[model samples]
Structures are given as structure tokens and as C-alpha cells.
Target: MNKIQQQKSENISFNYFSLLSLMFVKKYNIQINQKNEKNILSFYS
Candidate 1:
């Protein structure tokens, strides 16, 4: 029983970390895209 509970908690923590990392990656991608757009605009100007 204790082992089962431990496994469940570990799974939950792993899922939480996965979600956090996904969000971080998405935010990073958005920032990079915005930076690229600014560079392009500056080049045109």
C-alpha cells in the first residue's frame, strides 16, 4: 500500500514538471519569434 502511494505521488510530480517545462518552452518560443520579427523590421527600416 505504501509503495503504491509513493508511486502515485511520484507520477503526479513528474506530470507537474512536464507541464511546467512545456509552458516554459512555449514562452521561450514566443519570445524568440518576437525577437526575430523585430530584427526583420529593423532591417527593413
Candidate 2:
């Protein structure tokens, strides 16, 4: 019973970590895309 409870907690924490990492990755991707767009615009200008 105790082990099951511990496993549940671990699973919850793992899920939270994955969610945080996913958000971070999405933000990083957006920033990279914006930078690329800016570079392209500057090159054309």
C-alpha cells in the first residue's frame, strides 16, 4: 500500500516535469522562429 502511494506521487511529479519541459520547448521554438523572421526581414531591407 505504501509503495503504491509512493509510485503515484512519483508519477504525478514526472507528469508535472514533462509538462514544464514541454512549455519551455514551445517558448524556445517561438523565440527561435521570431528571430529567424527578424533576420530575414533585415536582410531584405
lDDT (CA) for every model shown? 0.92, 0.92
Clashing pairs in 1: none
Give the Cα RMSD of candidate 2.
5.6
- Please give the lDDT score for candidate 2: 0.92
Candidate 2 structure quality by residue, lDDT tens digits, 1-45: 999999999999999999999999999977887879987678779
lDDT at 26 for candidate 1? 92
lDDT of 1 by residue, 1-45 (tens): 999999999999999999999999999977887879987678779
Report model 2's TM-score to 2 decimal places. 0.71
> Which parts of model 1 are misplaced by more than 4 Å?
37-45
Model 1, global lDDT: 0.92
